[model samples]
Target: MTELPDTRLFDTVLVANRGEIACRVIRTLRARGIRSVAVYSEADAGARHVREADQALCIGPAAAAESYLNIAAVIGAARASDAQAVHPGYGFLSENLEFAKALEAAGITFIGPNIEALNVMGDKIRSKNHVAAAGVPVVPGISEPGLTDADLIAAAADIGYPLLIKPSAGGGGKGMHSVFAAEELPATLATARRVAAASFGDDTLFLERLVANPRHIEVQILGDTFGNVIHLGERECSLQRRHQKVIEEAPSPLLSGLDDGGAVRARIGAAACAAAASVNYTGAGTVEFLVSDDTPDEFFFMEMNTRLQVEHPVTEMVARVRGKSLDLVEWQLRIAAGEKIDFTQQDVTLEGHAVEARVYAESPAEGFLPATGTVVVLEESVAQRPGVRVDSSLARRLKITANYDPMLAKVIAWGTDRREALDRLDAALADYVVLGVPTNVEYLRLLVADPDVQAGRLDTNMIERKLPDMAFRTVDAGDYAAAALAARKVDVARPNAPGEAPAASSWGRLDGWRLGDPAPWRSAWAAPGRTGVVTVSGPQADSGTEGPGVVHVNGIGGDQESRTALDLNGTTGGELLWDGQERGYRVGMLGETVFLGSGGWSVALERLDREAATARMLAGLEREDAAADPQLRSPMPGTVTVVNAKTGDRVAAGDVLLAVEAMKMEHQITATMAGTVHIGVAVGALVKADQVVATVEPDEDNSTTIPEGE
Candidate 1:
């Protein structure tokens, strides 16, 4: 390690990001006695990060491009706050060369790598070539600038089948495709190009030979201006969906389970250090590698992330420096101030095991569709428990919209070993609750408890392969019973019946009360794709008894009814004797809908009226009559970016009518039947989840197919 002159750290730093990462950075800044400034958009005015920051300023509106990604606005915020430095906490402009350059021009320190490192490592094509020149092993690939489709087609034959198509620009698994056969090249290339252009504004693409049963391992490295860099072990991130990581763990189980694990670890760590040294990388960075699960000793360099990573907490939990835990954020701040690292590579040690699960606001059962809703109930108290850590941006009444990423928070755990860490993580998730918005919490719990996952049988495609077999628990009799009981317990005043006068006395109750016994009150409840009713005959008020009573519930989509025993002790929720066991749940009401949550699973049951129920039945009948409904609805709330069909356009079934993009994920709305299409939305228009964006009138005789090239 090279020695360097001492330099004072910045007095204040402006965080050019939002959500949990910003709050995470502020925590270290506050510990170091540095003032932290937060910048947010119009949509995040009341966000948790803003409230926690010492100073906050509004930069722009909700659109990320105009707000979080606005280079001018972010720089202006830093300038106005007299911030000596700015921390681009992952995502947004974290790795943008222009943002770093602008900060340099503004005389503010960039709490990340220098511009040179960003330029080389930011683009996949350039980084591969740059590191390859430095004698680093990289996956076999064809990379070049301005490679036309024709050129790629010619090169595909040489690269062979099972090749990965990746955009040169952007990160986070966007615009990535895998082609297993030659016949799938042309169309896939076109789609990849379009996504690349839309996402990163750069259509430059490259191809690499896909490593079968590949495992993603990334080393956490910290570098200083003194030309010193050290690794903090590796993280296993093989469990993913659609190329996005769902779960990550530190001190990869594959390496730890190997006979020569320490030797392989040293070699991989050295290669990562070389990759960073090639560009003189400074501050905290991650060097991702593609390691074959069959041969753990052999690893290939993938890419170098130029900023702090979302899974850095896992590394922090297990990495100790000089017998003390390390804070990567603090090191980033210190490195940016020209301070030299006092510890060497041999001084770093891994103590225990840690695991992290990303809590995304998505419906895993609905093809991982992004969800939108206002957070009505929150139960993040699990973070205070032993061995559990939660980095979240969730707050009560927080509106989870489609304008930003779907990641709501991250739950991490540290234990004596891998099994203990996984156990803690699963328990934390089960205790975690976020109602009013659908989340993948239940799916995450199922994943951690998977047999293959627990056995360390991990690969990039494991999650995708196991999804078909994973049984995701949804709304059941317990959910309906809890909703009905919660509704009965509500004390809100009820309006008089139509043309009926208000009660003259307390004896004249409007709540189905009688002289001898209160009549049973039946209420209908509806969830997505299902509806049920529950009848309660007992007293509306709590009995204050330990014994449980029973309520009859009509199963969804069936006439069969069953009795469910529930104990309501005047609490927000009740204990349900369900699935041959007594289970407890927490319940809250948002409007007429009751949200019940337990064991990391939640459901929103809405009070349904008789007229609405009848209409729903009629719609179900229509669906039964025609297999194709002709209605194209936006699967998620987002902005409509592409409108492929216009009104009166004859289209064939499976033709894409429009695309709605939210949280960087695009879901195409397709015509269900051959017909004349009527597009209801245009380009750049905001849409709601499940909102009807287009409709098609079935006309099989007049339907026409779209040209392949078009």
Candidate 2:
């Protein structure tokens, strides 16, 4: 660990990130009596991070580029708030070397790795060279710049048939391509280059020898100015998709060699420690390695992440087990202020096993398509059982947008051993409920229960290979059944229905039926792709007692046994079974019609003439049809940012029509098509919800052509 000057650090520090990381940092800072400041964009003004900070500043617009990634704005906010230090929490500008330098120039302490260390580690080629020169085993590959196709081909051939073409400046799996055959080189390289340019602003790439069936292991290292560096064991980040890790755990099951106490684990940890010391690295960083399961001796350098990783909580758990609190943010701040590590490597200890699963707002069934919507109901296990931890920033009624990463939260579980940890993790996931948006929770649950995962035989390709059916598995049948049952109960207990029975039978009827006062019932019904409303009513009664209800479909009374009977005069409604189980229903009036609760269905009474009723139904259908069309305009004012199709373009059903950029994030407008595009709105234009963004001309000969422009 490096040593630092003996001086007190800043009184206040500003956190320049959002979500759970920001909240986590603020809690630590407050506990230490260090004032914490926060910065938020427009969309995050009401976010948890903003509310938790001691003080907060509105940086800029909601787009990450305009706010979180706006280096200038962040520096200005730090200056205005009089914060002596700036903490870039995990993402955003955390690993950005230039941002660190800018803070230095402004005389504000940056709570992370120094600029020199960041510059070295930020560039993959430079970091690899430094690590290799330090006698650390590096992956066999070519890092030299400017290689032609022939040169790359020869290098690939030399490294063996299967190799990885990774962008020198890439992380998060973008611009990463694996090739097992020579013929796939050119196309893969092109894609890698394009992805690299888009993600990292650099097209420089390198080739690395690929290890077959390798576990992704990384060691957490901490260094201070005093030249003291210690390794805090390793984390297993083997569960990945498109090179992005979805789940991580500490004290790797693979490292323990199936819990048999293997010699390979100690050697790998030592090698990781050596890699960190080689670069003279200081502050919190991770040295990642790829370990082949088939051959223990075949471990090689993968990459080095220069900042605290997204999965840092697992490492924190390990530290807790050692009876010591390790604050990565504090370590960086103290080191930058000239503090040396107070403890030696042998002083650190590893404890219980911890597992972390990233909960993302993405649709696994839709090829992991990122989703955005209001989180109407976000529920987790109410009881925090032993060895369980949930790190999240989600709350009920929060909106998820497409402007940033889709990760909603990270759920971690800790136990004395791996099995216990795995068990806890599975339970936590099973109890989590996130409604109003698509998520991959169900998919993760399935993965954790897999035989390979349970056995700890993990690799980067584990999810892809073993859970091939995961993308199509949306809901667990048991969970769906439970939700359905709950929904039914809610509908039945509603008080709006006159004929609906109360849960308690204490209230007795005051009189016999002349006719029960008419009451309306509103109930909703939902299936896989269909939803509808059904309403029923009980007749007027002078005795104040409601009789069995009569069902009405669009105001027309059903010719059955009063549709379904309700025990209004008794405790608990008579079992009203639909599909299965006795569910309750409540009723209310909407205009002249009645709505049935317990099922969210509505019906209207046909008091008008037959001709008038038919006319009304047609009008209602037109309105419903218009509302269901996806080619409509935005409900609020916004700018058009994405135009997916043009005139004469052929489109399939459910293809995106365009995107509206409102409040900084983009909202895609999709096409409900079985035809060709006849008209569409241009990009950079303003739109409203019913405003037609595009018109589709059906392929059938009777198709009508809409106007060129709205």
Candidate 3:
């Protein structure tokens, strides 16, 4: 066991980050009795992390570069807060050498690797060269960051088709693109360069051979200043979308062959340690690898993240000794305080299997496009649940802006084995709910139950191959009828028998009025996306929103009609006895949307007036069509960085016309048809979601099909 090398523990610590990661570190600091300081941008003034920290400071405005990524601003905040050390979370300056050096110059501690270690591992090209010199295998490719685009094109020819263009400065799947042909290199290259520059402040790029149908495995590395280093086991991160990890699991299933103590795990573990020790790494870091299923014993280095990873929970769960997982952030603090690791490799042992699913605010049906809205209601929590944990940044009424990453939270579950863990994870995901924004929750629910995932047959290409078959569950005709019934039942106050005349409006309301037999109180409602009519008739007097009443519901689209007894207690839940089973759901009214939430499903119903709904729908259709016409709107909110095409400039389809940036990632705007361009927004101007940035007047003479701009 290594002893304490020095005694200089920080009394106050500042976390130079935001969101769930900052909250996570604050929790550790609280446990250690260390004063916690948090910094936030204007966009996150009242965010959860700010409220949780012991002290809060405003760094800058909304944009990340002006706030979190501003080294000077972060250091200034640290100094103002009187923090002795600063912990940079997974992203945003976590691996920045300049930030560490600045802290060092100011006599402040940066809780990561040393400057030389960061300089070596932070650069993908340099790290590859350094680790390869220590007898570690790397993906074969050209990695010269100084190469020109033409030179890169030449390099691609020798490397052959089906390679990847990657930024040399950062990972986390940002600015990484796969090329399938020689002709696609230039456009993909330009995109990678722009994204890399915007994301990592470095546009230098390189070419790496793409490993097809490979499993993503990463080892956790920890070291101290006394030259003692050890490695935790590997985590499986093969489930990915657009090169970003979506779901991760510990104890890769491929290592099942080596469960009886084979050399495979030991070999990979030693390699990761060697890679870390080569640069004298300190604190927590992760070394990612891509291993082929055909030869699980052989693997190639992908990249090493020089900071704590987003998937650290799974590793922590597997590495837990007692009821609590090891305080990795505490270890980070100790190492930063010049303390050495107190335990050897033999002290660490595997406990149980754990799986983590990253939940993002996106619509899977729309190609997983990011979405933003206020969270009306949130019921996700893992506090009371056993073997389940949720790390999130969500609060009721919290508006999710399009200014940062789309990831909302992570749900994790641990069990005695893989099946139990996955099953628990599925139930936990279903238990999680969010309203007022489109999310991939339902899509994730379906994914955990997939046959291949259940059988542990996973690869980086799993989601891409099964995407066409996946869909988001929507409310059906029955749900609409139930919604209409519930709506009318709760709105009536005066009682009228089944054959009595309909009640007139007490005040100035014209809703819930009818003039026919069997008409007690009639109302019409419509589902959001479906064009149909649903009507409900109920007893007039359902006092206090609950009474014994016979309700008749009908839907015109499917000719669905039903008569049943319903107890509508305003927002309180009722039961529906249908098709041999009784289903219970809680009914809540949110403006026009009616939410029927239950165990495993939630359906939203939009209240509609027959006349107004029809007119407004027609108007909405007109507005949508006009919005999609010649006007080219920005898909997301961002600042316009460059406008390439001018008014009256004739351009072919797919020509880059403008570029907008958000969260430091640049998005290019292209012409949909061969046409003359009419630019709307100028460079350096700020634009909101769906704001018109340009217009493309389609050239009638061209015969080639025009693709729509995203």
Clashes in model 1: which pairs?
Answer: none
**lDDT score, residue 259, model 3?**
51
Candidate lDDT (C-alpha), each: 0.86, 0.68, 0.78
User: For residues 25-131, could you state the per-residue lDDT of candidate 3 as single tens digits?
Assistant: 99888877789999999999978889999999999998888999999999999999999999998898899889999999999999999998999998999999899
Looking at model 3, the pairs that clash are: 495-541
Clashes of 1: 0
> In what order do the candidates fall by lDDT, top score first?
1, 3, 2
**Model 2 Cα lDDT, one tens digit per residue, 395-434:** 7667776566778788888888888988988888776666
- 10 residues in a row with least lDDT, candidate 2: 597-606
- TM-score for each model: 0.94, 0.75, 0.87
Name the lDDT of candidate 2: 0.68
Single out the weakest 10-residue window by summed lDDT for candidate 3: 540-549
Candidate 1, run of 10 with poorest lDDT: 540-549
* Deviation in Å, model 3, residue 570 alpha carbon: 6.6
What's the distance in Å from true for residue 675, model 1? 1.7
C-alpha-based local distance difference test score of model 3: 0.78
Which regions in candidate 3 have their CA more than 4 angstroms from the true location?
Answer: 1-8, 258-261, 320-324, 481-533, 540-560, 564-612, 619-631, 635-644, 651-677, 683-685, 698-710
